[model samples]
Target: MNLFMSFLLLFLLYTDKLAGLNFNTDVTVTWGQSHVAKSRNGEEMEFKMDQYSGASAQTNADFLFGRFDMRVKLNSPDSTGTITTFYLHSPNRDLWWDEADFEFIGGSSTADYKIHTNLITDGIGNREQQFRFPFDPASNYHTYSFFWTPQQIIWYVDGIPIRVYRKLSDSRILYPDKQPMKVYTSLWNSTAWTGEVNWKNAPFSAHYRNFYVNACVAWRDGSNVSSNCKIVPPFWFTYKLLPLERDMIIRMREQYMTYDYCNDKEKVTDVTSIECANNP
Candidate 1:
C-alpha cells in the first residue's frame, strides 16, 4: 500500500471509521432468505451459498442520487465460483435499464482477484472496466463507494478515486443520470463468467459491513426536485477531482487496470463510444 492508503486504513481502524455493524434489519433480502446468515464474529451480514442455492439482498427503497459506501471483505479460502457483487440496479428495466456494478470475479488465488466495474444505460451495458488492486482484497476489509450525480459517476475504493465517468455529447448514448436505483448485493454462481460454479467444495461466504448512504435530490436536467429535498450547494456533488484523486486515477489505469471496453479496438472497430472519445 502507498503512504496515503496506509495512513487512511490505520486511521479508520483506530477511529471507529471501519467498525463492523450488524445488518440484521438494515437491509431486505430479495432472494434466498434461507441462505442469509450472520458472521460468526457478529460483525457483518454474511451471504452464504452452497451447491443447492444462492443468496442476494438489497436496500429497502430506491434512491434518486446519492453516495453509497459499502465496506466488504471477500471470501478467503477456496473462493472459486463465489461471485460477490455490490451494485445499483434501476427499477425501470422494461422501459430502460440503468445500473452500476462492482463484480468481484472468482479466481483460483488472491493474485487473480479482479474488480469488474460497469455502467449500464438504456439496457446497453458495454461500459466495462476491470482492475487489479495492489493489496489482497480477501486479506482485509475495504470500503468501496460510488458518488453519483447529474454530472458524472465516480468509483472509489478505500477513499481513493479509481474511475470517473461523465456524460457524453451524443444524445443517443444513454447515461445513468435520470433514473432511480436500488442498492443490491448478491453471492451467486457465475460459471459463465467466473469459470465454473465449483460447488463440490460447497459453503462460500461473503461478508458485508458499514453500509452508508448520503443522499441528495439530484436530477440530470434543471427540473423539479422532490418535496422533502433540501436545497444543496453546487459544490456538494461534482466530478471536480482533487490532486490525490487525479493521481489515484492515473495510478490505477497505469498500473492495475486490466480491461477497458472503450479502449478495446477490436470491440469498437467501426463504432467508437462517444463517452470514451469525449472523456479522453
Candidate 2:
C-alpha cells in the first residue's frame, strides 16, 4: 500500500475511528436462536439463519452519530435474499423504519444501502434510494462504511465512497433529522423482491470480521473528504493504491481499468464484455 493508504489501513486495524462509536465485542444476539459455526481457534464466530422471513431481525448496540465500518465475507451461493445489513433507527418507537443502513444484497458480492424517510408504513414510497457497489467480497475480505449526519448519509467500501444521499426536507417531525440512532446489524432472506427463490444454487453464506466505528467528525458537509467520495473505484482499488512508480501505474491502469456496465450495453465495447454473446 502507499504511505497514506498503509497508514490508514493500520489505523483501521488498531483504532475504532472509522466506525464513529464503541462496539461491544463480547455481545452478540440473534433472533429465533440462530446457529453459530466456531473456528477451531475459538476466536471467530459465524451466525447462521435458515428459513425465509418476509422481515428482518436485528442485533444492535447503541450509537447516535458517527461512522460505521466492517470487514465482511458473505456465505455460500444464494439466488434470492436480503444479505446482511448495518442500520440505525429513530429512538421513537412510533417511527420505526425511519432509518438508514449499509445493506448487503445477495447474488452479487456488493453492498446496497438505503434511507427511509418515513415510518415502516407505506412500502417503497417513503423517499427511499439505493446505491450498489462491487466488492470481490466472496473470494476475499472487504470493508463497508457509512457516515451519517443530521441531513446527509454517505456509504463507503474500503475507504472508497459509493453513495451520498441527503434528506431534503424542512419538516423536523418527518425527518430522522437529529435523533440519536442506535446501531443495528442483521441478516434476512428477501426472496420476493430480490428475485426468484433458487435454493438449488443458493443458501450462500457471508462472513464478517474486524468491525469498528469511530466518531471523529461532527455532522457537516464540504469537509476534506477523499476524491473517492462519488465514484465507486475500480475493482483494482486495493491493488492500485499500493506504492509503485509511474510505469507500473500506467500498466495497471490500462489492463484493469474499465467502465463496462453490464446493464448499460452502450458502455460495453468488446466481445468479451457481452454476456452470453458466444451462445445462441
Candidate 3:
C-alpha cells in the first residue's frame, strides 16, 4: 500500500476497534455542580475550578475488575497547582480503602505535563510513580487507562502501556484484588504539593471525555457475568509484550519520566522487586 493508503488503513482499523464510550450517568457530582458543565455537545465533561471553587465527579456504582479509561485535556497557559484526578477505590476508609490513582500535578505550560500514578493497598504508605508527558496534553485529548485483573495491573496512555504492576510476587506486599472499586474523577486545588499559590496560577480547568469500561459489570457482585452488560477483556492482557511494551516504556521513561519509587535510592534495598527488573 502507498503511504497515504497505509496511514488511512491504520486509522480506520484503530477507530473500528475503538472501545465504546460510556459516561457514568449514575455518577455523583461530589461537589461544585456550578463549576461543572457538559460540553463537546455532551460528549465531554468540562470541570472547572477557580480561587473560589472546584469540581468533582465519581461513579455511583462499584465494579470488581475492568479496564477503565478517560480521555483528558489539561488546562493550558498556566496549569500549575490545580490537580486533576481519576481513580478507583472502595468506600472503605482508613486501612481498608483500596485505591489506584492517576493524578495530573499540572505544569506551567501545555507542553509540560506531569502525571503521578499510585497504588494504595489497604490504606498503607503511599506507593507513588511519576512521569512527565512530552506532548502538550492541553492541545488535544489523550486517553488514560487502567487495566485491573486477577493477575496484574497495567497503566496506559493512548493505548500504549506505560507501567505495569503485577499481582504481588513478594509475600511482603499486598494487592487490591478482593474488593470492587468506584471510579472517581475530580478537579481541585493541589497547591500544597504542587507549589505555593504563586507557583500555581489558579483559575484552571479540566476536560474529561466519555469514560469507557471494557469488562462485564457482574464481577462486582461476585459473578462471572452481568445481566445488563456483556463484554471481554482487551487483547493486551492475553499476549506477552515484554519486548514491545518494554521498549515503549523505556523510551518514555528515558525522555519524560520524572520520578519512580522503584528507583528511589533509599527505597531500593537488600531486597528488590522483579517488577522493577528493567522489564514491563
* Most accurate candidate by lDDT: 1
Pairs with steric clashes in candidate 3 = none
Better of 2 and 3 by TM-score: 3
Residue 268 C-alpha lDDT in model 3: 65
Give residue 181's lDDT in candidate 1 (0 to 100): 81
Q: Which stretches of candidate 3 lie over 4 Å from their true place?
A: 1-24, 39-42, 198-202, 218-242, 269-275
lDDT of each: 0.74, 0.45, 0.72
Estimate, for each residue in 1-280, the C-alpha lDDT of model 2 and write its tens digit. Answer: 5666664664455354343222224334445334444455433445555554322333344443456666766654443555566666643456243576555556532332221111221111132323333445566767776665444455555764444444443232233433445555566666665655456643445455665665322222343222222254322222222232233323432443232133355534453233213111
Q: At residue 213, what lDDT does model 3 achieve?
A: 73
Q: Can you tell me which runs of candidate 1 are displaced by over 4 Å?
A: 1-22, 39-43, 217-227, 230-235, 269-272
TM-score of 1: 0.83
Model 2 poorest 10 in a row by lDDT = 115-124
lDDT of 1 by residue, 214-262 (tens): 6553333344434123465333355344456667788888899999988
Number of the top TM-score candidate: 1
Count of clashes in candidate 2: 17
Q: How many clashing residue pairs appear in each of the predictions shown?
A: 0, 17, 0
Where does the lowest 10-residue lDDT sum fall in candidate 1? Answer: 13-22
